[model samples]
Target: MLSQFMVLFGFFALVLVSIVWINKAVRMFDRLIGDGQPAWVFVEFTALTLPGVIGVVLPIAAFAAAVYVVNRLSSESELTVMQATGYSPLRLARPVLVFGVIVAVMMSLLAHYLIPGSLSQLRLRQDEVSRNISAKLLSDGEFLHPAPGITFYIREITQTGELRDVFLSDRRDPEAPVTYTSSRAYLVQEGGGTRLVMVSGLAQNIGADQNRLFTTYFDDFSYDISSLVSRDVVNLDEVAFANTLEMLRDPEAVATRTGTTYGTVMSQTHGRITAALLCVIAALVGFCTLLVGAHSRFGVWRQVLLAFGLLVGIKIVESIVVAPVLLNGALWPLLYLPVLLGLVLSGLLLSIASHPGVWRRLMGRGRRSAEVAS
Candidate 1:
């Protein structure tokens, strides 16, 4: 159990760190979009969607860690002692299978429920930020003050994408509408508010939608726009936010009706179930490998390679199986068969490897007892 726990713990930690680093690297490309936002903003955005990242990386890491720990134990002669004490491969592997079951359930929860909900929230927040009329949208060299409740201006935009020559108008209160114009402007976000600073501008008020337009200009203008309600209105049912109970209650309804090909759905479902089962498969494979001679130089490395190879093979098979299912709805459940087969095979192999010596010793003892009785 300790060995199994260490393997699972180490794998989870490594995968989490790797995911964070990968997220950072992936976000660097966002800077090229020239959104005038700091790279850290993109990083934070990625961080908010990390549950999906965890779902993808956890199974691979678990498989690798299982092989690694088992190999380490085999190399150190600990596995040999356990085997001699009549601890069959199945007995040693039991902890790993147990761990796998736990992880599988957790991952299932994450993939089908938690990740989708979190992603929905992240998307909603992103939409809100993008739609917000703030300093981020201001550009230079454009006559921006087009109408009431609007202000716009432009200057020679810097290569770094900063705004200059900002203008603004506010008709939010029809009774006392205000307008301000400036030669230069900068945007700042603080305390849940977005503010624009205009230099060398003016302020005035014009009549509402009438010929009586009164305008006054100012040398400098400063205004604040609340960064609230920027999010696009979305219906909860349209978003993917089903929890486990919800999914179980209505699995068919939980699936999106985007006219997805049967093959694609099959593939996706297969991938999800396979990922969950990998924990059990990895544990069984590791336990069987541990039954080899402790002093063997290459045994551990061989098992590690085998485990990785099997994992890759499973992924490839899943992709292949899912392709047909995407084209035809009939093949959806078939995708799960490979994962089930892998688990069964691993269990059987572990059982055989763990007890070869035990059976031989028991048979010898039985023969000796029979001869004494005769």
Candidate 2:
């Protein structure tokens, strides 16, 4: 059973991850390709995103695999045969527990190690790509808006990399809209930033208050292009980039370094730990829920819905607890409520499955009472 669960878990994980990753990759592909980036860059970005996706979907896949394997076995009467052989529900659950533990280990590796590393690398790559302004702005004969309220157009580019017939419109300051035109422009690098040096350019400013125009001509002027294409500075000391150990060991230092509060750092750290335990809860809940049902030739769709509802209940508890925990570091233990609820629910299901005859007797007595009343 453990082997079967492992195989189906792998299959479900692959299918789900591919579906989600492709959706995200499609949007990223358009953005990167539209910006004149290469195919390899898109591939690299998509690859870096896979660890985070897998971390989210692995527990779900584990639950699905357990539910499916048990449903198939029940439909085939294999579970009935095992019960006839004196195998208890608790005995049957041993393999499922093992499978859940294995998946929890995988989730642990991702939550503590792989996800943070990949996120940090992705941020670094994004920083480098965002600052590459020449690729986005150097195209000639087309109007480009690098940032909101800024329009730029270049008529031609020389073999020596000089831009000709430059047109720039800066409406960022709505009260004083400005436009600049120049016969030629040269890109200059100074102080680790790129500047457009326009020779013999005319600057036009329109005052919205008085509806008046002002024009000025200069032999040379410098325009800042780096600021237009640059993104928010990536926080090198982001708390999420650190492992859970580092955060827990010195939360004060981590909070100070990342410019965040102790509550936020502690929440992020404990959140990872609870997330791993959720995999175990999900699998146990799924298997135990299905085991509560009797033998049926048709299917156990009702039990499936019940299992889903239980999972949703767990999520509701999680959503209710997370906010307070995030606001107050002392409430960090609230994050484990979901896992505890899941385990308690799973145990109840197993107990009901073990003594299935008691429920049938109670139902029969109720029917007799109903018939007498009628």
Candidate 3:
């Protein structure tokens, strides 16, 4: 059961993560490739996002595999034989517990190390790519949108890398829209900044506030384009990308970089630890729920549905707890409630399954009373 659960979990997680990552990567290709990035850049971006996808998929996969294996065993009567041979529910759960622990360890590794490292590298690569104009962001005879509300078009490119008939539109400031057209232009790299040097050009500005148009023609012109694209790595500093140890050691710094509260950083750091525990809880929940009733000849489909229901309830509780915890750090401990609830429910279900006599007697008494009333 343990081995099967592990194999199934790995398979499902891989398939799920691949589908999700590829879907997202397709959307990214539209933006990144449209900005003139190469195909390899898209591949690299998708690769860097994979660890986070795996981390998100692992726990759910473990639960699903555990439920499927348990249902199969119950349907096959193997679980009944073991029970008749004096195997308690708790005893039968040994393999599942081991499976859960193994999955938990994998989740811990991803949460603490792999995910953070991948995200950090992803951010750095994205920042570097965003800053370099020569890297991408230019194509002849096509309109290029370097940033929001900013567009550039070049009619032709010369052998010496000069631009002929260049047009740029900047609407970053909604109150004033600026348009520049030039007969000849050069993209000059200087002092870690990119500048558009235009010769024999005209600048047109439409001021919405004044409701008027202003135009200027010049022999020579220059526009600083460093602001058009992100030039610094700071643009990539999100809380999800920060190291767990770093968040624990210096939450204040994390808050500053991520534009979030110190409490939010702490919640995120501790949330990773708690999420790993939930993976174990998820496995146990699936395994124990199937032990709640006697073996069914029709198969354990009811128990399978019950197990999924329990998992959904636990996830709902997790979602409910997250908001309060993030809002106030004082409520951070509540994040473990869902895990605790799962563990408690699993223990109760296993206990009941082990001592079916008590449950049978109670049901018998209730049926007898109902008959008397009728």
Top-TM-score structure, candidate number: 2
The 0-to-1 C-alpha lDDT of every candidate, in the order given, reads: 0.62, 0.90, 0.85
Leading candidate by lDDT: 2
Q: List model 3 lDDT by residue over 247-267, tens digit each.
A: 878888889988998668878
- Candidate 1's TM-score reads 0.66
Off by over 4 Å in 1: 19-22, 25-44, 138-163, 166-182, 185-271, 290-295, 351-374
Clashing pairs counted in every model:
26, 0, 0
Model 1, 230-301: lDDT tens digits are 444654453244354544444455556434343444455555666677656655555555454335765666
Error of 3 at 173 (Å): 11
Q: Estimate each model's TM-score.
A: 0.66, 0.82, 0.81
Kindly report the root-mean-square deviation of model 1 from the true structure over all alpha carbons: 10.2
The deviation in Å at residue 75 for candidate 3 is 3.1
Residue 107, model 1: lDDT of: 81
Pairs of residues at least 3 apart in sequence or in different chains that clash in candidate 2: none
Q: Alpha-carbon error at 63 in model 1, in Å?
A: 1.5
lDDT, candidate 1, equals: 0.62
- What tens-digit string does per-residue lDDT give for candidate 2 at 275-373? 889889999999999998777777899999999899888978988888887788888888888998998999989989999889879879999999999
- Which has the better lDDT: candidate 1, or candidate 2? 2
